[model samples]
Target: MDTLTTTKPLATYVVRHADDNLVLGQRLSEYISWAPELEEDLAIANLALDHIGVAHHLYDYAAEVEDDGRDADGFAFLRDERQFTNVQLVERPNTDFAHIMARQFFVDAYQVPLWDALARSADERLAGIAAKAAKEARYHLRHSRMWVLRLGDGTEESHRRMQAAIDELWRFTGELFEADDLTDELAAAGIGVDPATLEAPWRRTVLATLAEATLDEPHETVMRTGGRRGLHTEALGHLLAEMQFLQRAYPGLEW
Candidate 1:
């Protein structure tokens, strides 16, 4: 089946995941140099690598239908913030280790379900990619869950920090479950998962994990958005400036 004529279902899923991972990966990369500890530096770098690896697989699929001849690297390093289609949460700053762990806990937990749903997509290519990414996401979730438990159940300060992080990040969590036109069309065609359907299960998983970690759920409230449509925060502009510096300065230069 020609995906282009079929509303480009699989391609949208791959590209969405890829764009989210790439943007988040770029944000995490910034911490490599600023992390308070060397172990943390390595861990952030590893996480960034994992996200970029998943992105490579996703973007490769997207490139097949891309009008331009650009490949994954080109798609990754070349795009400006306005061109990105990631969720707003990914671009949020890592305020502290506890906050970082909290955010990762939410994202990684959500990633597991997202990939698992895609693994059963009507699109075979997307299912194959999701199968591969699901394995990686599983581990990522475990790592994040462990940190959440430790921080949440640790000393008074650690517990307070973990709870505060969760409160600060809750607003962003709503966007993960928010779907758009592309998702609606794809879900109807059975080529994509409805992010809305995953909300209850996702919330259950999060609540369970947080309970195990001794974390409390804050009252649900207004959620922030805009990354899905390429509108990002001021911080994203700074991030893009750094990530796209070499690309913008020397356009068409690639090793």
Candidate 2:
């Protein structure tokens, strides 16, 4: 039960989720000054901070599990694209406000339940991190759900755009629930939540929200994946270039 001395599997399991938050945090940060309203800009900024905060905690825990001298910053800034294990969904470009909301909604919907489940993880440290993260994810869900409803049920043009955004991102949702070997092993040990078990409730929660928003769910076809194994879209490379620039350029520079 002493996770710090655990093998790489535990560290990998924890950091994979950290990668999701770190990647999405960086994505949301890109919208910093550009959101439509002043209050909304501040909201997005706060959300970005929340995500990055969670990422740091998870990364900190992962580093401890690895029993390496590497810290959170090393995980955040030193890893190359292929080394990242975040899902592809969070890495998609924020094309527009509707797109942003759609992406946020899908991710928030998933994370709220994910954190809730993780809060009870057999790993006490991860459970503590999840307990804190669950609070932020609920707030994030409210923010995204509000915008999704407002846009999807408002003007005809807004409805079209929101629907388009939903369609564009739907394929990525499947990957969020797919359970693989790492998850299987961890779940059996009670050290992690099996995402496969989370999918049904996630569907109910998401579909209910979409119905309330008067939006049609996109039919599923292919599910985009591979981020767990370090395969990502081109966007991640560009994102890493910008996000890692300071650390990469400065090497060991301190503030």
Candidate 3:
């Protein structure tokens, strides 16, 4: 676990977003050489770099916000799963190709609007970071959106699998817009985008894509919670173990 815990609103907000990018970046990197096609492998690798690159920028900004002398490496490598503030959606495992694309599409859909909103933020640094991330997110959404259309409208088997992936992952979507007290305060101050306000647009984007892909909107189900507060599925622990192994094994080791 990290030694310094911060409660400053901007740093908290920045760390949460940084965690989102970093966790999703790590998850995408798992497909490094494993994508189904050569072109896709390269594309996914680039997308992973884009996400990790944003994470590095966000973490650096977070360290600046906290002003506790900890840097980007400290936040990215020193924190435990319980200290991570990412949404659970990003932490989900790559169960299969259908599941992978489904998950990516969902997050990409949310993040596109999110970064777009933040690009107009009161905090200039965050807005700068969001401006860059917004471009990458648009491309990420396009890539995932194309795959979703192909898989969902392709064959009976592909459609069935894609639908199944959507259904299973639906339970985790609610948390995307669940804003906490701190988040609400930050939103009011214009330092953060209130996730609650993004839901309507996100719904429009997602539902339209689902419709085009001939996929059904999932029925409302019990949604998972607590990722922002550090409660997580067992999956994050295993992931953190692997992700943090090098830094943990050799403290202060640098490339």
Poorest lDDT segment (10 consecutive residues) of candidate 3: 1-10
Model 2 spans > 4 angstroms off: 1-7
Per-residue accuracy of model 2 over 126-234 as CA lDDT, tens digit each: 9999999999999999999999999999999999999999999999888899899999999999989999888987788789988999999898679998888888899
lDDT of 1 by residue, 1-255 (tens): 221211355555667789888878887887787775788788889999999888898899888866457788777777766777788788878788887778777888888888899999888888898888889888888888888898889999999999999998899888899888888988898888899987887788789988997888889789988776777777777877888888789987868
Candidate 3 wrongly placed segments (more than 4 Å): 1-5
Candidate of highest TM-score: 3
lDDT of 3 by residue, 21-126 (tens): 8998999898788888999999888988998999999999899989999999999898877899888998999888888899999999999999999999999999
Write down the lDDT of every candidate, Cα atoms only: 0.81, 0.90, 0.90
Worst 10 residues of 1 by lDDT: 1-10
Candidate 3 vs. true structure, TM-score: 0.97
| Candidate 2 root-mean-square deviation in Å | 3.3
